[model samples]
Target: MLQIDLWKRVLIWALVLCGLALAMPNLFYSRVETHNDAVKAIAASGGVASPDQTAEAAEWPSFLPSGLVNLGLDLRGGAHLLAEVQVSDVYADRMDGLWPEVRDTLRAERATIGTIRRVDSAPDELRVQVGEPAQIAQAVALVRDLARPIVSLTGVGASDIDVSAEGADVVVRLSEAEKQATDTRTMQQSLEIIRRRVDEVGTREPTIQRQGEDRVLIQVPGIGSADELKELIGTTARLTFQPVVGRTTDGSADPGARNLLLPSLDNPGEYYIIEDRTVVSGEELTDAQPAFDQNGRPAVNFRFNPAGARKFGTYTAENIGSPFAIVLDSEVISAPVIQSHIAGGSGIITGNFDVEESTQLAVLLRAGALPAKMTFLEERTIGPELGADSIAAGKIACIVAFSAVLIFMALSYGFFGMVANLALIINVGLIFGLLSLIGATLTLPGIAGIVLTIGMAVDANVLVYERIREELKTSKGPARAIELGYERALSAILDANVTTFIIATILFIMGSGPVRGFAVTLALGILTSVFTSIYLTRLFIVMWFERRRPKTIEV
Candidate 1:
């Protein structure tokens, strides 16, 4: 009478087989990884496979599951960087953008203010000198009118900029509340841009997270070095098209008002004096691709959105025959003369760039520019050898713990313990299988969690075996004792594992990085262990009991 139904038995075996099959790829980790990469590369290349990729893809069969547990930084080796975003740079950019609006506003009130000119001030401050000192109040009032209400919750109803008269000049600066909002937005944007850039390289399990107020922590598991990562992310790649005022050989040439002198990228010592006001910024770009120019030279082609297209078309049409400077990261890449009206918002950037440079530029353009500059605070390149050592140590610890648990269970509970030990093995396989299915990164702490799980996995079997022994002492038959053992132990097993599962969930939600990795494995181990102990182990016992038809048994 102690028996599992046909459907339940089938389900248990099915789950076990599925778990083992999914976890099989890890046995040949490098081969499967290579095959997966080759497949992905072929897919990315529009299904056109190279000879090497084809050979690599053939290493693994197409019918089998290919998922493998992603190794974490502690297991894989990588780059780590702590970067401090120069948030105040955003304030400078905001002020520079505000100047055009402020100039246009004051020009409309020229009758009273006479004339207005941007004067020297802090990078974060916009100071305008009013020709008519008597009308300074009117100038301040006009500038203040340009201030829009901050859209953030904390800064609701507060103006974005603070305006006041500094002697004869009206001084404008971002308000404290607006600065706080900008800092938050800047950090978020930086994080996103960094993530996109890292993802573009097709690396695995990169950690890009915000630290304190303006710091970002980036841990890339497969990058060569921190310097390499810094290079990939540090370049702002801020592309802008601006009206070129004139070309100059002098680096320190005065570009007059509202103009910038930027060095040409292709020609050393030559500079382009361009309007600081952007005709079209890279933020409006929707697509960028590396392609060959008319002369077969490597170049980048870019297409802008509708609004950007309209503005670009209007600017080019109105300024035909004048040169427009294509600026990247404060340097002029090229100053091409516009012979006629160029519409459609599509253009080419031709410079002294090779194929790799063009491709990298395209990637950066597609990813968008960082909102502010970042200063690297801490940088480290974890070597693969060290990671291998950690992995080896973790493996030894898990094996020792696993063997000890298996031996203890077998010695203490005898034949019943062997069944539980088998279930424990399946439980671990299920954990790895689940991790693979979800593409979870396994850290050293995650391995520790698995080891801890192995020890705890036998608790349910212990309770059931003790109950059976007690029932047998009360003169109950073997079949009846086994049934009562599982039935009575079910509540205790659920209560204990349920509480542990809740704690694991809380840790996952509240923790990050390695802590979250531990939580994930711990939570998964709980589920799998519970299934194996209560269901799989019971099925094994019931099958053995039904076949043997024993009169008496020892737990």
Candidate 2:
């Protein structure tokens, strides 16, 4: 009788929680039912296609993504990649591959550059030492065109490796500021490239970022082909256009070409001459989409920016029927002749291509060309062999853990033990409901969190059972003892659940990925256990006592 009032209160609490569970699908979520109906209708044979006209489809707009907890990468197999960036290529491009050319031109002038070699590491910077034996002043004066870092200046006979070139060579030797900048730029460029490649191949929601300076971090949510991805992403498809060498000044085209030349549109073959400029650049193109031309041949449709359009219009206007090479990575794709003025800034490129070849070309062109070419630094892959084994091991561990807890509760408290186990099952249900409601991701460690919960959930039942036995020792009636049991155990149960909850909350805040998963399951279990133990188990106890009203109680 002393604890009957408390039992009533906890029974009411359970009822209230049941009501909250009913409202959860609407409170935290809305319109899920409508979306499901619409998707079902769409799957049917005579479904309405219009989202507006279809009653079911009209409700599709309010639907949220399934906010269910997803098993994480460790439980589910996926690929992870770490890559390094090489930025020395940027400086090398800036030099325009003229190290040997510049050296030869200087030598022809009879300038005695003492020593000439490209920096072994930087490779972009050429170190030149002048003076027959070592005349630094003479060397500097002779090579005024070359930028200076006259490392060992010579007045008359100063002979000590006078490395006078762009200080970029010395920058490599210093190895702090220069290396950092190179690493930063390389990572930035590589991230951009990787993101594009991921998009091209239809990999969804990829995360690409600079990890430190030289390394790139890439996370792809649902991609499978690690090897294919590595090959695609690692290719630094750098494209370049070198002005084709030919025809001279004085209104003269190459022999058998004067008829092909016409007046330029912007240049009029005059001031600001189109002839001075390279005909086309990849930078001008906005997008390249695969398509078939009027003749049913595979082609890539291209759109150019206003400036590129003007450059292109003038080139086509001047060289009415002359062919221009479309070079990709120095290999010519097509050297199509100018057919029309192409004034609208959009046109198509036709070649001997099939649909697949044409589509890939368009994808690459849309991704944009890399600034500098790259070589593959490294590659690694994880096979599914190990992940499958881990899944099996985790399943066995969960079954053993659940069995242990179930037996312990049944042996420890007779009929009350059975009720506690029933409450535990409902407790697990609430955890899943909460997870589905909140979109938390599940993981391997999360399975541990749930398994640990089985043993812990029995603690409240043990507290109540022990309290009943103590009251019974005083020769109290079974009903009176049961009521007193709940009353005495309430404070300790609250305090224990509250403390565990705080720890789980803290874990959720501080951890990432699998750790966060563990926190989620642990925290949710604390809440559900509190509900089921106090309310569901209490309801069973109250009914059991009211019906049996036994003269003697068995512990």
Candidate 3:
């Protein structure tokens, strides 16, 4: 009997209806996208919306499914940047942090190693000269105690820094294995910080990923330009509070070896000499928000954690009437005198900032600083006009291919061909439905995959139809012929589609960006095609045969 069980029939139709419902929003893509954006904006504004936003949000019914396929960078047009992280900067920072520990450790062994002074070398190397040349070996041994085990898979049992004595100086630098591990960690941290900064702007589906040892690839769709993306992420935003030594009007003035000379934010040509040691850094910040100061000026309010609060309070208590500088990215944003002990662990940063600047600063501070500076190696801004053209072309290609396939199938296989046509249409719908469900971005290559799928979708139906034609010649009844046709062709269909699915899976695993996009659509198309070809079309034919009670039917 050419029959499907009652429950299976319900399941098939249910899935078809659900898929179509999920895909319906893509037909009104722009309107639904606008509605979604408006809804998000309203929620972000604490359930308040402007008249325009409210109207836009109301354009689409809330009861219906609203998820749409996200367009990729190539499809939506946006900023593209390939940046190389200045990973060596982190080495310098690490050495700077290690200096105090080395100084204190050597001072503890001062009786044997004598006094020590830091000598200039490469930015990455920490060279210290011992007053007693004969005890240089002792100084090296003491500094070596400061080395910690590298917590990395390839660096097991290896210390982070290699300490050796050269002449009268104790030379210390990161080990080669430790450098590799640090590079990996720096790239990971840079990628994460960039992602956080981009996500804070509320963009849809930005791709920020590590490309190589010291590089990151960032593609942000719907952004204005590449420069805008750069400006958003490039600032580092390393905030610190340090005690001020003095103020100067000269840029070339030296502030000693352990201090820094930074320019003021508001006053032109005015600089301040600040201590290099920070009282509390941005890493201790628990929260930051854009708010107005007491004078109604734009400012950023920040709160610190308990440990940071204790340190800050103690410093303020001891430094009454002394000025402290708020430094951001090595520039003095503010230098204010401490009037009394500030025990609240909260403070405000007031600079020459507008509302937008303050908001951006708050966002950057909240996102945390990038581990290292990144230099853009490649940058390109895609225009919306190009994206629109590509989308239009893709739509035309899909429609033409679809119409040609439908016409050819209808003429060759007759009624059965039309059934295959219906299945193919539903197959495409299910693909989009799955894509939307997964929040997958659709690129130009993904569209090409869909067009290819339109042709491949009917392969199983064709095999089954040809098999039925052969069975009919062997004098079998229409029902038996149809049953045997699907049963016999099942192995071949599975073999072909399964092989293709494996290839798609491999491509998805090994590829990135647009290649993965193509693989995703291809894989989904295969699954949906198999379901429709083997089950849904067969169900329709079985229902038709049962209704007519046909003894024989033409292929």
Candidate 4:
């Protein structure tokens, strides 16, 4: 009964060997990490590695597994930021876009709704006053027809916009369901753009995720500070081309109803009145790079997609000799006259830009624009010195806990206890091996979970050994007593570990950040401990029994 099947024996040994092999890289973490990064960089560069990079990549053997457990912020230091997206900004932009369509629809029925005039209203509302009060109902109905069914899962059968009439004025706003859908899209886009921006900088293991309907939580390990992280992602980088109506020195100049007056970036106090409708938005841009102008001044070169190129070429041809303003986040970066038909859909933006500004602009343009503005609600920078201290403290705690558990087990059960201690050592190794194989993050709380696991690794052996002692008082032989002990202990061992694993799973699902990290290590440790204690320790004892067939044994 104590004999393991041949297949089972092979499986157990193979699992252990594979786990150790996968986790071996962590023993030389720095070297392995460098090799991995170098390999990635060379691959990205079309497999052409520099001499230094090739030498660094050769430090680790090609056949060995290179995966290492990622270190968490508390163990590696980084920047953390909680930002709330202004979803209302998108609502206002949607309302602005709806105005042209509303005007066209109303103009076709001018005899019925009278002369409709756009009126100033709330940012989220599109308001229009009708000259004929009697036709207000018809006007509302016509605007309501503009509403399309929302295609989102949660917004099924709901209209995208709600149309209501306030006296002679028809007001339009996004429906509640549409607003919810918009918020979800905004958060998703923000998360993706943030990830792209952070990844472009090559920061290792940056966490960019949405916290709620309108908030994002970003953590970047090995980054300098929260401010630096914010600077990298904060700029909206909204570039637009609008026809310049007029130029003035007065900031208070009213540039008519459909024009906006923005101050020039290069010239202080100088302002330009530009058309509100963008000729081509940066969303159509496909590429942006920093390059020197013909005069050797820093500038940004941009290329547009096909549709954008066609529109830009047509606009440039029609508006030749007129100045067009390049606006970035409400500031007029430059105003240049259309000299030619610019058919290729490529152009240069020249400003009083330094080399760094041009480079940053290019990076922002390449990463695309954020869907909405974000207000940082919380920010913190964790120092590497604190992380180092945490690592040292965690190591000391693990060593002390491990030593105490080892001594206690050896004293309690003698030679059998020593076999369990050996299994315990391998148990810890298996924990690290699984963690490395899975690429789980190691945090301070995770370290505590592993230490706790070390203390509990011999639990199954304790149960079986105590049962053996109980059986020895009976008339059973040593081999029969041992087999019966293991058989009787199996059910209790399964029940305890299963229940504990369920709790760990719940923690991982419900908790955030460090708690999840702790749950991961705890769950993995429980699995590894059960395997080593029941199977590996039993195999050791069986081998000892075969080697020395004694009639009686000491408990």
User: How do all models score by TM-score?
Assistant: 0.92, 0.55, 0.92, 0.83
Clash statistics: count for each candidate: 0, 4, 0, 0
Q: Write model 4 residue lDDT over 42-85, tens digit each, in one string.
A: 88556889999999999999888999888889998999999999
Checking candidate 1 for backbone clashes, the offending pairs are: none
Would you list the rank order by TM-score, best first? 1, 3, 4, 2
What 10-residue stretch in candidate 2 is worst by lDDT? 265-274
lDDT of 3 by residue, 81-109 (tens): 99999999999999988998999999888
TM-score of 4: 0.83
- What is the lDDT of every predicted structure here? 0.92, 0.62, 0.92, 0.90
**Which candidate model has the greater lDDT, 1 or 4?**
1
lDDT of 2 by residue, 386-472 (tens): 556766778798788877877888898888888998888767656766776675656678878888777678888888889989999
Off by over 4 Å in 2: 1-82, 91-121, 124-178, 188-196, 199-213, 216-225, 239-328, 334-381, 413-443, 453-555
Question: Model 1 lDDT vs. the true structure?
Answer: 0.92
Best-to-worst lDDT order: 3, 1, 4, 2
Error of 4 at 498 (Å): 1.1
